[model samples]
Target: MNVLKDVATGVGLVLATPVHMLGRLVSNVWWPLKGVKDEIVLITGGGSGIGKGMALKFADLGATVVIWDVNKKGADAVVAEIREKHGQDRAHAYAIDITDREKVYALAKQVKREVGAVTILVNNAGIVTGKPFLEADDSKMVKTMEVNTIAHFWTTKAFLPDMLEKNHGHIVTVASSAGKVGVASLADYCASKFGAVGFDESIRFELRKMGKTGVHTTCVCPFFIDTGMFEGAKTKVPWLLPILKPELVVDRTIRAIRMNQATVAIPRFLYFGQFLQGILPPSISDAIVDLFGANDSMDDFIGRTKKD
Candidate 1:
């Protein structure tokens, strides 16, 4: 009888797993956006471009939004827009450098006291230097790593403790599709984004080991956006790999977080490409990249001029 009972339990789980997954797939399609109301959402680099767009969307959903940016002016502008869309209390802004570990922790404490525990943490701050690896300045490379990759570590450390304490929180990383594959002129930027992708994967496993079922992680890897950061990037096949729009990225990101998606590649083409990387030979992969114009997307690069 004991042996029969154990067998029955194992069989039941095996049968239920597929049913549960199917149900979830249907639910995601039918009822996409969930949770998020009244949650405190903290977004780094929330002043402009994709960050600013996400802040507005969060406010529209009734979440208390916090914007953190090195450029205080840009953060303030976002807060102002949130206020107009929702109300004064719906949004807040802080001027702090996420690359500075000490400052990130300090601001986290302040935000906890003034706003509330951050229920959703978005590590979206990033920078790029569009130049060949040999011509790239050493300082620019270091800063790229600092802002694009290291900042995620510091921000997650500062806010993750509270989330773990409650066993309920979400961490979202805005990595790039460049993180998935190498680009000719974006070597430093690609390396930092690759780090971001690896970091998120490790953190997700850590949560699983700790048996923290309620904590969720979402990592987004998208192609270059039309945001000023990648002003001149273009695809050889526009329909296949067009530059992403900020609004589209923001919409997908918010939906992914609400639905607890683990990882998403914008347009879904990149997902197939990443799969091919594992099976295809190096020469074939290089040919595919060339055929798609990924090799020359940055030939006329002129990144954002203003420091913001």
Candidate 2:
């Protein structure tokens, strides 16, 4: 009976593999998008840049949007803009340091009581210290990790229980291309983003193992975006790795969430780069990177003046 079961499993895999691949291909062009009208979405760093862009877009789509940022004025402005279009009940804002676990937990309970359970969480807040490893301050490095990586733990802890109970939620990690590959003068940023990418992947597996298939995860790895957060960054190959626009990144991220894409590397070319990176020898890969000047992309880096 065990032998028969193994044979059946092999046959099922053979039949399903090709169909699954085809479905994935078709999904890029056309997939039934999940609705957000009934969702309560919590966005970290929603005062500006990608977070603010997503907050506005989600509210326009009819989801109740919650903005969290340390900058009270910025967060309030975003909330007001959203409320103007969707009505006051459609948007809310909170000013709190995400790295403070106690504050995050307290706010989570308050949010649950005031606004419904957060059905989607965007861990989009991040910071960068654009300095060579030795020149960078220890405090800045620690802060970078706290904001870009550690905060995910607190935020997820705050909201994931409700998701697990309901068996429905989406967690979006706004990682970066720097997360996938190393760049000079951004060692701290790279390390934090790498942690974020790994966190998203691991949680995805855990959710599947726990039979919480309704809870989805999307890891977004986009090249340098022109949001003032990365003000003076540059790219060598304009056609291949042009600095992306915030609007384009936000739109793609929203689409990925609605379609439940597991991971999306912007411009699609990055996909090929990642594939090549894995198959090629390290020396050869490094040579390719040198040829493309990937490491030099941040040479002129003058990152956001005021940290989010």
Candidate 3:
């Protein structure tokens, strides 16, 4: 009887899948956010890498983009490039330390006044320190937490009230694949990203409970990209766990935001990683991780500074 019941449930889900997809398609067609002229989108850490890529894409799509970063020169350079490609008025750059709550709030208000209503918020700022657990200092750990995890709270709190009132907005949190699986030598980085993932989930739940389904939330977790941050990180299975390009990640991320996807794991194999951990024996899993040199590969880590 149990077997038959399970089969019936599976069949029901299969039959309902098309209807669910069709509903989403129709809803999106009626209320498309992509290429919506004059829509304001704000991206943190928009100075370089994935953030800069997304900003360029959005501006090309006719959105007014605000590039917020602590690196004023980098931010201005990106804005200059955007202005050359898309009209001068389409992109703006601001220097901001997202970790400061009051500063973030002030920036949000300034953006609203100077640009327009912010329809999209992308929290893409992060820093990674590759020290071993024993060598990790409190100051380094605190900075990581401030930038990667707590900044999300500050940004969300500052912008969400406006979203709730307007009833239209999207929030994208750029976390790391490290958040899903704990590896050696990156304890602090992993912990900070894990907190970001959790924070995204909790906010999603709160939105659902409040009946604000239109306020879309997406959490992105990707493996080592060819970004400056992971300059020396080696991939055990290049084909399976290939280091992604920043442009590719940015493209997919923008598409996800436009479509209002709730979460995304790049490389696709990451879902299998999650499944494996749930079923694999502890010793077996540990052996696999060790074989990949997943932890100690960062022993000679040289990040963005080295790239310079």
Give lDDT tens digits, candidate 1, residues 143-236: 9999999989889998999999999999999998988899999999999999999999999999999999889999999898888988877788
* Worst lDDT 10-window in candidate 1: 24-33
Tens digit of lDDT per residue, candidate 3, span 103-198? Answer: 999989998888887888899988988888888888998999999999999999888888899888888999988989997888999999999999
lDDT of 2 by residue, 114-164 (tens): 998999999999889999999999999999999999999999999999999
Error of 3 at 172 (Å): 0.3
For lDDT, the strongest prediction is 2
Off by over 4 Å in 1: 1-28
Order of the predicted models by lDDT, top scorer first:
2, 1, 3
Off by over 4 Å in 3: 1-36
How far residue 4's Cα lies from its native spot in candidate 2, in Å, is 12
When 1 and 3 are scored with lDDT, the better candidate is: 1
State model 3's lDDT: 0.87
For model 3, the run of ten residues with the poorest summed lDDT: 27-36
Model 3 collision count: 0
Q: What's the TM-score of every candidate structure?
A: 0.91, 0.94, 0.88
Model 1 clash pairs are: none
The stretch of ten residues in a row with the least summed lDDT in candidate 2 is 299-308
